[model samples]
Target: MAEIKILGAGPVKRGVTQIAAQFEQGTGHRVNVEFTGAPTVRERVLAGEAVDVAVVPQSAMEEFVAQGRVSADTRVTLGRSRMGLALRKGAAAPDLTTVAAFKQAVAAADAVVVNVASSGNYVVKLLEKQGFSADKAVKQPDTVKVMDHVASSAQNLLGAGQLPEIRELVDKGVAIALAGPLPDELQSITAYDAAVTTASANAAAAAEFAAYLELPAARAAMAATGID
Candidate 1:
């Protein structure tokens, strides 16, 4: 049996974690997963961490391939994730169908919460381009903490994160309202990709697991976790 160590971003956590268990059971391979922000994952890999496989944003994976940290031939596209907004439960959901309405909602919000990751950075830039200052936006370390802050805070808070991360919390009936995905024009869709690491000791096994993630069952698992 081979043991595979996987490093990935927050958006693919739930889906990958769930599928990893299934992969282990089916192939007798032990899967160890480490999930963090997208930027952190890239930093760790680039810093020469001994990861067997990595699931990261497509852009980051491409850079890794170029840097000879990961095998480009082994890269497999995971699904895409869009930014989404969440509010405290029982609060009135805002109209975010249009970018103008989204701007209004942000302007009227008491406070905005975003993580210090890919989705949050994108939202901040988008807000700035729309003439809104994100300086006051509460930044958390991860998406889960962002939801936790919004859930516990008495203040009316608007939380922004990747759809998969926020949707997982919403599915669990967290004390947050699903305000839906960001408008198309304002949305930043990040494509996720997985590839075997060049430093992998179990390169063959890692390649096998990467291929497994592209199977129909794996795609279904990702879809169930809101990764599509």
Candidate 2:
């Protein structure tokens, strides 16, 4: 079996995991996926970790290409993830139809949980620009843990993360209510891309897997997991 090692961000975890399984079934290849925050994956790849494929935010992929760590021709845009606000299952959903309302909801929360990943970083910057100090906000290392903290928090907490991850947690019976994607004007949509790493041992197989991510079946899997 062709063993392919993949490193990716948390937002793409659910969709990638599903698509990887389909890929394995169809091609008889064994895929080993490692999910982490976007920055961590980028750092590891840049540090020359031995990975066949690297899947990360489009921006990070472009940087890799510029640094000659990933081939530009091999880059494929996988899908986009939108930032979302989540509350505990029994908590009342907040109004997020406009930027002002979103700011208000955030300000009113007793505590807020965010990850240090792409979506969370965007939220933090946006909040700062809006002159709001997320004094009560806590930044976690990744989306899954952020969601977990929100679910278990004794106080009413607002959880901000990528829609795909939040949806996955909800599917797993996590007690949380996803308010929805942030307002259009304030929305941070992160596009993910996949490419064969420069240091890949199995370049041919890695390239094939990167191409497979764009196929209809893989796209469908991504869409099913809120990663369109």
Best by lDDT: 1
What is the per-residue lDDT of model 2 for residues 1-228, given as tens digits with 9 covering 90 to 100? 689999988578888888999999999999999887788898999998889999998888889998889877888988888888999898889999998898888888886789887677788888888777767668998877888888898887999988888888999999888988889998888889999999999888888899999899999998998888
Estimate every model's Cα lDDT from 0 to 1.
Answer: 0.89, 0.87
Q: How many angstroms is residue 129 displaced in model 2 relative to the true structure, after the best TM-score fit?
A: 2.5
Assess candidate 1 and give its TM-score to the true structure: 0.96
Q: Write the per-residue lDDT of candidate 1 for residues 75-139, one digit (tens) a residue.
A: 99989888889999998999899998998888888878988887788887887898877675889
The per-residue C-alpha lDDT of model 2 at residue 51 equals 96
TM-scores for candidates 1 onward, in order: 0.96, 0.95
Q: Where does model 2 exceed 4 Å of error?
A: none
RMSD of each: 1.2, 1.3
